[model samples]
Target: MRVKLIESRKVYDGEVSMRLERFSINGRTVDKEIVEHRPSVGIIAVEDDRIFLVSQYRRAADRALLEIPAGKIEEGETPVAAAKREMDEEIGYSGTLKPFLKWYLAPGYDTELMHLFVAKNLHRIPSRREMDDDEDIAVKKVRLDAAVKKCFSGEITDAKTIAAILAYRLKPI
Candidate 1:
């Protein structure tokens, strides 16, 4: 399916107000407006039975929360590349990252599409995030089961984290 622009509306000339997704289905043209958004990447960093995670202060959550490594994809970056870069930057690890799952983080208001991945065959190195800007992350290594429990306990409420964990379980080793 490809978007064939039929008509466009300028909501705000200052910034990208919205994009009308125009496409054809069964010889009929359809249009759906979507907010312009950036793609994101997530990782379930795993080693043996343990999964690497991070604990950080989520301003929206009002406290420090546990979650798998994730971040937004920068301009002109692919999801697969973003996954590898995030794994290396956030957790100080690098290895084969298999594409796990892809979904919309929240479709109601935001157009954030997340690409979840499993970073297997990890190599532990010194953390590169020694002194980062506006980020204070505490690295944690938890058993996969424990991570799942924390997710259920609401200690980890991020959708990407939950999706990554579930994908890890369903995927073939």
Candidate 2:
């Protein structure tokens, strides 16, 4: 299968941008609206039997959601640095980070790739980094086993958080 990019035009720009992409596959032209987004990192911070999570209102979802500490990798920042920084800002912890998984958040129409990490040997930051001005986040601690149950019970609704918990349960890093 051969795919060729015919054209891409930025249609919307803000916190994230939208691109209208026209592609040709095997002489068949197709158009897809892609959401241009920066790569991000999600951290599963574990200590003893507890896993740290954050609950915040997501504008898109129109409600509060329980999610792992996560954020975009800023310009010139590596994914590891983003993971550590997100932990500090969202969960107020620092730890040794290990790469876990990398996957696209919504490949069908989005370009956001999420790098997942397992953060162990945790220590609370004396003065946690301030979260983004528009964000109001509350940290939550859950037992490792219970977190998995929440994933299945629909209590934990974030895709990245569900993926991390299930993956960690299947095989702890």
Candidate 3:
């Protein structure tokens, strides 16, 4: 089981997508194409027993989504730094953070990995939410139980949201 690169080259360089294809194999030969994405961060911002979420329209999904605060780690930025920045920009808060789990968003075809964090002992700050000029984002707060319920209700359709809440529920205090 190994990726044998027969041929590979960068396909595109854009704000959201950078794709590549490699000729590969497990037991047989196959051409595998993967998108090389910037690493991202997901924050489960906690204050007492509540979690922060952002609701916005997703052009890809064509519906409003309730998701954990998240963004890509820019060049030369650590995942923790990106998470802190996203938490403040999206929720207007910064806090002492507890490192949590990390996971790949979609391993089948993408190279996007996400670092998950729990931020607590919080304080308010002015938000600099310059979400893509086309974005329509609204911030909200919810109890962890309610947020988990929203996941079951499919009101929270984002992967990072579900992963963060489930990890919080499973971790021992």
Candidate 4:
């Protein structure tokens, strides 16, 4: 299947922009509201048997969510660099990072590709970066086994976190 963009116009612009797009697929013209978002990184930071996570209030979710440390890749930044930076800012830790998986957050309308990473051999940063002004995050450390149970019991509702924990459990790096 081939999809060709017919036209795109900026509909909203902010931290994340939105574009009204027309596409041609197999001779049919369809319209979609595409969210123009930068690629992001999520880290499954592990030390011993615990996984570092963040709990923060998400405007879209309307509640505090427990999620793996994650953030958007800054302009001119590599995914690995973003992962490290996010870990430092959100969890005050750093480690050896290995690529685990990469996938679109929501392909139907969003252009945000998420780079998942497994971070091990963790060390606390003496001078970790400050969290973003708009962010109020609290760090949470959970046992790996219990975290996996949360993923199964729906306590961990964040998609990226669920995928990372389950994937790591299924195939540890």
Candidate 5:
């Protein structure tokens, strides 16, 4: 399949955008609208069998979410750098991060790719990174097993969190 972008403009500046595109497949062409989002990084930060997570209200979901540390990949920054930045900003910690997985968060209608990482040997930072003006995050440390259970029990519903937990369990750092 070959896809061409017809037009794109940020629907929500700095967050998401609407994209008009045309796809050619097997001599047939179809036009589709998509959500063009900046790629981001999500980290499964671990220390002594515990996972660092953050809880916050998600306006789009109309509910609070328990999720791993994550943020958009800033321009000219590598995925690992973004992971480190989010970890410090959200959890007030730093660690050694290794690539675990990469996947499209929502491929059918969104262009956001999430780079997942596993952060081990974490240490607390003297000062936490400032949260964004609109963000209020509560940090939580859950045992690895309990975090995994939360995923199966539907308590941890964030896509990146679920995927990262399972991935780390499969191949720990």
Candidate 6:
């Protein structure tokens, strides 16, 4: 796809940013808005037969969600490093990370590329990284098979978590 930019303006700048733009594509022109987000990583931390999950309230969604440990890739950080960091901070454990999948969260109007990894051989740490001030995460554990079932039964609704669970089921690391 080819798009010629006519104008671009930043509309919001917080943890996530948004931009409004005008672009023309192949003789057609239109205005568009996009979310500018740093790349992020989600870790499917599986130890034994269980998968680690985190339950936290999402202010934007106004409800608690069950999800895998995840966070934005910081500046100058690789996806694998971000995955390890998120696992440590959120789950208080670290594991061997194997990249599983990568996809755009919303390509139509977003620049967020999500990297998913399956973490194995987990071991607890004496002290984990501190959580972000805005985050209040509760760790949860469920049978790996049951988690995959939840994905198909609507219990696991978070997109990244669902994708990671299914991907691990299909092609485990």
Compared with the true structure, the alpha-carbon lDDT of candidate 5 equals 0.87
Error of 4 at 47 (Å): 0.9
Over 1-173, each residue of candidate 1 has an lDDT whose tens digit, in order, gives 45456676644432335765666766688777777667889888888899989887888878887788888788888988888777777788887888877899879655788888877888876756443464577878998888778778887787778777766766745
**lDDT of model 1, residue 5:** 64
* Candidate no. 3 TM-score: 0.91
The residue-level lDDT of candidate 1 at 44 comes to 83
Error of 4 at 88 (Å): 0.8
Better of 1 and 4 by lDDT: 4
- Worst-scoring 10-residue span by lDDT in model 3: 126-135
In terms of lDDT, model 3 sits at 0.82
* Model 1, position 91: C-alpha lDDT score: 85
Question: What does candidate 6's lDDT look like per residue over 38-144, in tens digits?
Answer: 99999888888899999999988898889999999999999999998999899999889998889998899999999988899999988989899879999999998
- TM match of model 6 to true structure: 0.93
For model 3, how big is the CA root-mean-square deviation? 1.7
**Model 6 misplaced regions, further than 4 Å:** none
RMSD of 6: 1.4
Q: Rank by lDDT, descending?
A: 4, 2, 6, 5, 3, 1
Q: Which is better, 1 or 6, measured by lDDT?
A: 6
Per-candidate Cα lDDT values, in order, are 0.77, 0.92, 0.82, 0.93, 0.87, 0.90
Worst 10 residues of 2 by lDDT: 126-135
Query: Which regions of candidate 2 fall more than 4 Å away from where they truly are?
Result: none
TM-score of each model, in listed order: 0.76, 0.96, 0.91, 0.95, 0.90, 0.93
lDDT of 4 by residue, 5-75 (tens): 99999989999999999999988999999999999999999888899989998999998889999999999
TM-score for candidate 2, residues paired by index: 0.96
* Candidates arranged by TM-score, highest first: 2, 4, 6, 3, 5, 1
| Pairs with steric clashes in candidate 6 | none
